[model samples]
Target: MVETADLTNHFLIAMPQLTDPNFSQTVTYICEHSREGALGIVINRPLDLRLREILAHMDLEADDAAVAELPVYLGGPVQTDRGFIVHPGTERWESTMEVTDGISVTSSRDILGAIARGRGPQRMLVALGYAGWASGQLEREIAENAWLSGPADPEILFELPHGARWSAAAARLGVDLTLISGQAGHG
Candidate 1:
């Protein structure tokens, strides 16, 4: 059986024919991997939300002078009300996951406060919610060819424009999304 550890720091690119309303054209970055299950955040789906808006709702001080000009992404279906920050390695915070060589996810409010104060990582993705799978579920799906896994690219996760993330991730595998077929096949 495949293990989550084997898929850590990887990208789960949706298959061409993926029709799930929540996952179509999604690019996910795996964070925690264990025998129990795995957790990741979708790096490409935006929900018309922003950091300032979220902070305002939370009643957390919004430092307009410092917040970067970036939009928050819908990480996944879980806990859409919460916040998660994926950023560069140079910045440090509590409850962080080094998703890749230079990319990390921080769940602590401290990092958010820093970002709001203009003292956070130079590059970052603020995600609300995350994608997850129970033990063996993700492996079973992979066996069914529901996804293609590849190493996560830091720049692709943090530097590219939000709308381009899906295509950019597929490009790493030499795939043109338009050529993909959502229908899964079985022999």
Candidate 2:
């Protein structure tokens, strides 16, 4: 059966055994999930690219140096050419989609322009591409203990350092991934 359970605004913590190079040790924030499929941005994988570099490429200059210095993340393996911004805001933008009450994902250049002008939301994660799962693919992965799902924590997503996110996310659900064996027991 396809999962009807909405994972919007949830965090999928990769289990210790989930050695997929794309998702292992990552904390993915689910932005949209439906009967058809799911889309998410991996929160903890920082790409070497900086926002300043992206801005320069787009010919958008930032008013604030720190904002320009923000790290751009490797969101996932899909659509690596695109950019996505995850932020907490209620304002609608040209391509903004509300993942929850205050959480949103915007791909429009307008938002990036605002960010460049120091008018963007205070907290944001800029990522390239996103994690996607075909219908029932995530459910099957969960059933196989490839991931642990729990409420998404804004602080973990926006405030914490990238290296700390995985354990911190799993700890929110009281799981110590290191304590779990990578090899599963066969019945």
Candidate 3:
């Protein structure tokens, strides 16, 4: 059984059998979950795009002098033009979704500006694009063993190194992810 409404702020760890190139070894943070569908950001993959580049393209300024360094992550394949930032919960900007207890996702340009100005949330991950599933879609995948869902930790979403996030997140569930076989069949 799946906990649908409570999926928001949780992490979905891709099962080894998820052959979709886009989701292999992925750790996604659920940003929204409603009857409309589910939306998330992939936390484990980093792309060549940088936060500075994204901000510049959005016509936002990055005050290198005041702003701390930023890291860009590969959110997902959907809406590559759009950007999403996962951060610690804060009230400075709007357009945020509580992804977990202490984590939030911000897409407003104002938040980007604040980050550039060094007034942003204490922790964050800037990502372009996001993973989405239509109503009943994600649930179907999970039932097929395409993913393992679990609660998310603030550190796992915002602080763990990108390459290690998948494994780390799986470990939180007491599962040895490497042992998960990708071959799928009806049990």
Candidate 4:
């Protein structure tokens, strides 16, 4: 039997053929992956909401002038009301998952409090929700050509403009997504 490698710290780029409204033309950063299942956060697809709005809603005080305008992303389709913070740092938060040596995901409000105090991770993306898959589900989707996996680039996640993330992630594999057909082909 062939061993399946874990995809932790990888990026999953949606193929053009993927018409799922939740994931079409999106780039997802895999924070955890195992034989049991997988969990990731979409790096693109910002909603109309802003970080300030969320802060206000949660009654968490923040540096309003600095973070108010920051775009809040729609991480994925699952648990849309929950918040997730993908950031770079080793500092442990209340409910944090160390995704890689330099990156992590925090789901607790304490991190938000730290962020509000301007003491959080240097680079971070605040998002709501996350993508998830059952055992064997992601592997099957990859086999079906629904997504292309590649190494995760922190620059793409934290530095690039949100609209460019999808193509940028695909470009990492030398793929020009625009030229790809939406129809599936079998050899």
Candidate 5:
């Protein structure tokens, strides 16, 4: 049997027809994928909440005005109260996992404390919750034409405006989302 390709460091762009409010038109960055399951963060769903507010809620004061104002993303519907952070893979943190050569996801409170004190990763995207798929579930979804999978680009992941990530991620695969039909009937 051919081994299925692993999709770590990839993006899952919701298909145009995927109207589920939680995932509609979103680009999710895959952090880890295995036979057991998958974990990802929605890169384009910035909530009204900001990092500074989260810090204050945690009883930490912001040491840098700019970092505090950074937008916090609604990573996904799972574990909505938890926090997750995506940043350049740099420095050792209490709970940091290097998802790619230059990308890391930190979930420990120390990293957040560091961020509040202006000592966190220079570039980071704060998020709450994460998208998850049970074993074989994500593969099935892709096979069902619910998403477009492509290599995750850091520029689109961390640099672009939140609203641009959806199309930008799909563009990396040379697939124009606008051209994809919203109707989902097999020909």
Candidate 6:
């Protein structure tokens, strides 16, 4: 067995050869990682739905005039109906998991209510579902060269355009993924 370091608060940039429709060209934030397993959210794949539509569906009142048109992201391929919020705030909400020193994930409706009322965290990314891996699964994938990971940068998460995140995440490792060949070579 190979020992693997926990990748919590890291970003997994999919290699071009990964080719998985759900993760291709994606940048996923590792929220939790351990010997038990790992879980993450894809930060770059926004869904067609808007925060207003979701608020309406949940019967939450929102100050429409105050609510910006926030696009919800497809966190991953798992639990497609569950919602998760990656935000940077000190206020703790129900079902919230502190991913790192300054970042957290909240899956409670109250946070959504706060957002609707324009009183939520200052920066947030609303997502549905998440990517998951069983024990040893992620490490195996890493060994297979399916991903390149680097320290998580909140700026990339909150400031970069969704379409540019994958490349930006890879750049953190000084890697230009575009230059990586799809075929593996043996020396």
lDDT values for all models: 0.81, 0.93, 0.82, 0.90, 0.90, 0.90
**Model 1, residue 162: what's the lDDT?**
76
Query: How does residue 45 of candidate 4 score in lDDT?
Result: 91
* 71-92: candidate 4 lDDT, tens digit per residue: 8999999999999999998999
- Highest-lDDT candidate: 2
User: Candidate 3: worst 10 consecutive residues by lDDT?
Assistant: 62-71
Off by over 4 Å in 6: 64-66
Task: Flag the better candidate by TM-score, 4 or 6.
Answer: 6
Question: Stretches of candidate 3 above 4 Å error?
Answer: 1-5, 64-69, 184-187
Error of 4 at 16 (Å): 0.5
Number of the candidate with higher lDDT, 1 or 2 = 2
Give lDDT for model 2. 0.93
TM-score of each: 0.88, 0.96, 0.88, 0.94, 0.94, 0.95
Per-residue error for 95 in candidate 3, Å, reads 2.0
* Candidate 4 to truth, TM: 0.94
lDDT measured at residue 2 in model 1 versus the true structure, 0 to 100: 66
Candidate 1 vs candidate 4: the TM-score winner is 4
Could you say which candidate leads in TM-score?
A: 2
What order do you get sorting by lDDT, best first? 2, 6, 5, 4, 3, 1
Q: How many backbone clashes does candidate 5 have?
A: 0
Per-residue lDDT of 115-141 in model 5, one digit per residue for the tens?
Answer: 888888888889999999988889888
Worst 10 residues of 2 by lDDT: 1-10
Q: Say which prediction, candidate 2 or candidate 5, comes out ahead on lDDT.
A: 2
> In angstroms, how far off is 58's CA in candidate 3?
3.6
lDDT of 1 by residue, 1-187 (tens): 7643478888999886677888888999988777788899999998787778777665665555346446889999999877899887846688776666677789988887777776778777889999998989899888877788888888888888878888889899898878776565797
Record all residue pairs in model 1 with backbone atoms less than 3 Å apart, i.e. clashing. 17-181, 17-182
- What ranges in model 4 sit over 4 Å off? 1-3, 184-187
**lDDT string, candidate 3, 1-187, tens digits:** 3545458888999987777899988999988887778999998888876777777877877777424346778799999778888878656466887665667788888898888777787678888899999888888788778889898888887677888888899999999987877665699
